[model samples]
Target: MIKEKAKKKWDLTRKMLEITDDEYNGVTQEDANLRFIKTKLQIAVYYLRMLDEHNCEYEVPWNKEQFKWLLRKPAGDTKKQKAKDWCHQCCLIRDKACASWSYEEATA
Candidate 1:
């Protein structure tokens, strides 16, 4: 049973992740945001499907650090600085993916 909330969330995520026909009918896996969003939705759907299979009520963690709303960014940082830092970090979910983000995590 797909809940209204889950359906909406999945729809939104899918739209953000997929490239439109106008966007170069040919796609590349090198697009980081597109790749990440695809992987994230896969995990979300996997968990939801697992819940259904087990007849369990799956509670999405709306407070996970992986989600932008739950992210803790440095205070007083400018958009340019943040964008630079994000590039430097490459949005690596793995702790040791980059030294700069690793340093940020350590200090934060």
Candidate 2:
């Protein structure tokens, strides 16, 4: 059930992020905020995919060195840095959710 809910959330987020060229050209500040949200959702969906691929037992901590590359700040743009922070937080949330789901599955 938790997996199904995650899948549904991923699908909805993907749909929400699908904007056409015209829509992108007309983006307002609110649209930019939505894009930021979409970015976070995309990261969370990736975590969900990784968890599902490994049967919810994906060991992120074991691969910390490899994943640390994700936290590296880009050469410029504070906005990008902010986005990275948001993505990191999203990852943490998904990681906790993945662990909880794994425990639930193990006991079932």
Instruction: Give the winner by lDDT.
Output: 2
Residue runs of model 2 more than 4 Å from their true location after superposition: 1-13, 57-90, 93-108
Residue-wise C-alpha lDDT for candidate 2, range 1-108, written one tens digit per residue: 356665664585456446546445655654555455446546755775556544554333323342333323231344445446656765775667665553334564
What TM-score would each prediction reach against the true structure?
0.32, 0.41
User: Please, what are the lDDT tens digits per residue for candidate 1 over residues 41-96?
Assistant: 44545454434433344344432344443122221224234333433333232223
Q: Candidate 1 — which residues are off by over 4 angstroms? A: 1-30, 63-108
In TM-score terms, candidate 1 sits at: 0.32
Q: Scored by Cα lDDT, where does model 1 land?
A: 0.40
Candidate 1 shows a clash count of 0
Model 2 C-alpha lDDT versus the unseen true structure: 0.51
lDDT of each structure? 0.40, 0.51
lDDT of 2 at 6: 50
